[model samples]
Target: MITMPSIGDNLARLRRRAGFTQENLAERSTVSVSVIRKLERGDRDSASLPTLRKLATALDVTTVALFHPVPRFAPGNTDDRDDLYVMRRVLQPARALSGGGVVTLADDEDAPSSTDVWQSVREINGMFRDSDYAAGVAALPTAITYARAATSAAPEPHQATAWEQLAQTYQTAAMILIQLRKDDLAYYALGLAIDAAHQAGSDMLVASAVCSENWLLTRQARFNEAERAALATAEAIEPSLTRSPQSDIATWGWLNLGAAAAATRNNRMDVAMDSLRRARAAAHVAVGYRSPHVTHWTTFSPAVVAMREVELAMVTGDAGRALKAARSVPSSARPAITYQRFRLDVAAAHIERRHHDEALDVLLQLRATAAGWLRYQRYAHTLTSRLLRSRARAIPLELRDLADFLDVSD
Candidate 1:
């Protein structure tokens, strides 16, 4: 689904169009001739955003212009591609009614209680956090439908809670779809989530939904948009450290963390680091909160702050720092698929350190523990591919097995 060409492709096309030889471009950008050559020849996965900015400045283009985001999907067979049909039906149903009316298959059925609807929403969240994506996906439509019915049928005071529940369900559905790379459907679900959140008249809820929006944008390589939206939301919801509730601080901190992620990917090192610092400050307050709060069960845990530090360091190709930061996140009791993604950073750090056996060990452990979720992670596949390519001889059976599971091919 990622249509972007390889960065090398974009670079070659742009350089030729601009009538600049590699040497000429290097002279203009102050990048080494060798680095430019390696990049154009596709020998490197990526350059730091600042390096890319220099290249873009010389080419008279935005920094993003140099980025051909790496493709994130494993090869999909026919069955795999259509696996989201049920979700699509729910999210993008071709309803016959366009009258701004509630259309339903069970109009005569009584609306569920606000309590029931909220419970259903919580169950779906629980399922997703447990990595029971099948249960989560199966539960989503029912939860969304019941929530919608409640919004119309519940008492006026209860209707707001219904709307909020609906918003949360929609957002959760979007999160699931995003993991599956059903981005179009995720977008549809997120649009409805935003609407329901706004209708709930809770600015905090809306902010929470926007956190998901920021994540989606970040994944799609829309770094500038993600950064702008997240920073703005964080600013709007900037809680008073002394008086704000723990949830408020967590939400505000989560926004900064989101901003940090976007900024990191865009290669704005200073901006990303600053946002991480702010998020860490908030994490100090949220430490007492044991229950997951806000979007994707995100908390301002020191682990999360450390996770971002590791991510930023990895993106900037600082394996040593990444490995150091990785130590801050405990290896035990890392709950939620969202937080579990940090292990990939750990594996990548091991790779960078040329600890191939250690890297493989980490990946194998991750899959052994979270097999279902690992199948959906394109980064895992990408990392596996790297290890596979780097193996000069004797590809281990486990490595081969992992590659097959990831649908990775030579």
Candidate 2:
């Protein structure tokens, strides 16, 4: 029998899992915050049908779904799976990344070997390294499927490793999806990643997953939540770092926190800079000491530290420092780390120095390198459009080429 207490507990669980506060739900559902609070706390036994409907709508579920454990094989189940599979296929084409391209529903998941799982993880990592965002996004469900199968197939201790790998894989997928403007998918992937990390008892993996979620929150413009998530990740890893001096993982948390702070409009530039300085120092320690785990997963070389510092400098309006740091990163090598976004920064810096020719040169190089469909392409186009919009003098021919690419005429 489903008692009122059981019902209330379920409601509270689902509400929290959906990343909502009582006030947030109340605002969306047109129910008083206190009434919703009372329902969750078992202080209210009954709600009107209309109030329930509002709650269901705000939660993006049917009222019946709210009351019951959703069956994995229900009609809605297949509906969600089909939607997920199609989305996976569309956003993640096979050739977009290095490894196995797509996961057919008919693929045999029951027969994967340990080697197969390891190779797949490597491929996923390569996809991220290559900035194959779409392919990385597509491979998420496949990873989760393999992860679930691995648990049932592997014996006790091995199951833990399987969970950890899946958590990392899902975290990567979540980050890629966030960049692609797929917020709902990003949220779900990160949630799954967090659960798997906890199940595996991997504090490091847990912090990594939290970092990804913090990024998703930042993108959603939820500055407060982003800061909290980043800070929590840093705090989780700080204790471990003290004993082991594992700088790479520790620096990652700090870097993420600094990114969140820098992104907020109200963020103090000095504080952000200080955080970044600490991150850079930690990254140097990680790179120098060469811990095996850090080398395998969290290695931060001098180049990465320099690039991140440059990015922070640009955000903080230190153009000369940004320019010097930008030159420190070889163009061919840095693309994998920063993606095409760096080109826009270089161009912006050039414009700041009244070097439109140099700026146009960087923008043209970007056009040649980045595939036209990527979001960065649109960003470059817009920036170039703005630069060319109002000029005191006649537009240079090189600048005109950029205007043509953006499909905007002066």
Candidate 3:
């Protein structure tokens, strides 16, 4: 959300790189020196498109270069290496043919039937939905191998189904990696998912993979890129609101929500709100719809839109609005995964208001009910760490337990 190395930071860095002072850049671009000074001092959060274009021309760089900042993260430990090695090898096999070509798929039923493959994939999808990450990740490799085999070995009539499931399996793997903060690997997995989706010749399947890509980019703080990608995909698949199937409408609405989240992070509230309005129309028709494709998100619904509004409010640090929107998130029949995230947003709102005990209570409940999901959330870790800082001594036992579970050090 206007993350580090912001527009101001970029302008200052680019100005220096171009060997121009504030006055020099102003004179070169025919923009005022005061505006330039205000921008570099972080007084201005953004520039008009025309102003940015002029500055880009003067700096001999593209307008978008000003908005690009690689998302930063803390260093991962050695355990990540070991935990991910098998997954890495499965997605990217050894390149050298001369190497002792190891055997693969040694089981008796290497080429699983299409029915068997779909059943396994559905189970894996359930694991993902249940936040059973340990079982999900453990089951992924075998599922992927079987899905790959089924693509060629399954009955000819069902080959398309095989490819579709393959895409689903890969997208699931990508989602898991995204949770692990392994964005690079997630990118590769989504690439494979897209390829498989295209091979299946299912536009809906491809839309699912594209949605996953948007999710990954959003987490990485590539806000504009995510919004652009999601909006583009939505445009391509913009369904006939009156005629398209519920799946079509749901997919379209989900993309709009992704765009909304990304745009809000960039402080484009108008753009974000416009996206929400677009999604709302679709959600009305496809309320409480479930996915036929394995990709998560129980079809875009009013409940989800309300949940996301709370999240978007948090992005802008408008805790008052966040808590207000939280009231609209449905108490009954709420999508289980989405409600959990809304709970986090509620906790974040409390944190913003310095309601530390309330925040801890929310997190403690999540830890009790969704420990697997809670374990992988960097947001939880950061919130726990922040709470820890506020109490240097006599730590509350519940706070200490949460901090320890999230591996947050004071």
Higher lDDT: candidate 1 or 3?
3
Candidate 2's residue-wise lDDT over 275-335, tens digit each?
Answer: 5665665655555443332112354555655666665566667778878888876664432
RMSD of each: 21.4, 17.9, 22.3
After superposition, candidate 2 runs with Cα above 4 Å error: 1-110, 137-140, 239-264, 288-297, 332-335, 372-374, 390-410
Residue-by-residue lDDT tens digits, candidate 1, 367-395: 88888788888889989999998899989
List runs of model 3 lying over 4 Å from the truth: 1-75, 96-103, 106-111, 331-335
Model 1: how far residue 148 lies from native, Å: 0.8
Clashing residue pairs for model 3 = none
lDDT of 1: 0.74
**Cα TM-score of candidate 3:** 0.77
lDDT of 1 at 232: 96
Alpha-carbon deviation at 59 in model 1, angstroms: 66
Tens digit of per-residue lDDT, candidate 3, span 1-410: 32323567888999999999999999999877876777787765444434555888999996557655523223344345545555676688777654311213323233466666767677667767777654555456556766776786768788788898899989888887777678898899999999998998988878888888988899889999999989998999899988998888988888999999999989898999999999899899998677664655446788888898889889988999999888877666355677888898899999899988889899999999888778778788888888888775799999988887777898
Clashes per prediction? 0, 0, 0
Quote the positional error of residue 405 for candidate 3 in Å: 1.3
- The lowest-lDDT stretch of 10 consecutive residues in candidate 3 is 100-109
Query: Distance from true position, residue 212, model 1, in Å?
Result: 1.1
Give Cα distance to truth, residue 2, candidate 3, Å: 40
Return the lDDT, model 2, position 303: 61
Off by over 4 Å in 1: 1-82, 98-108, 290-298, 333-335
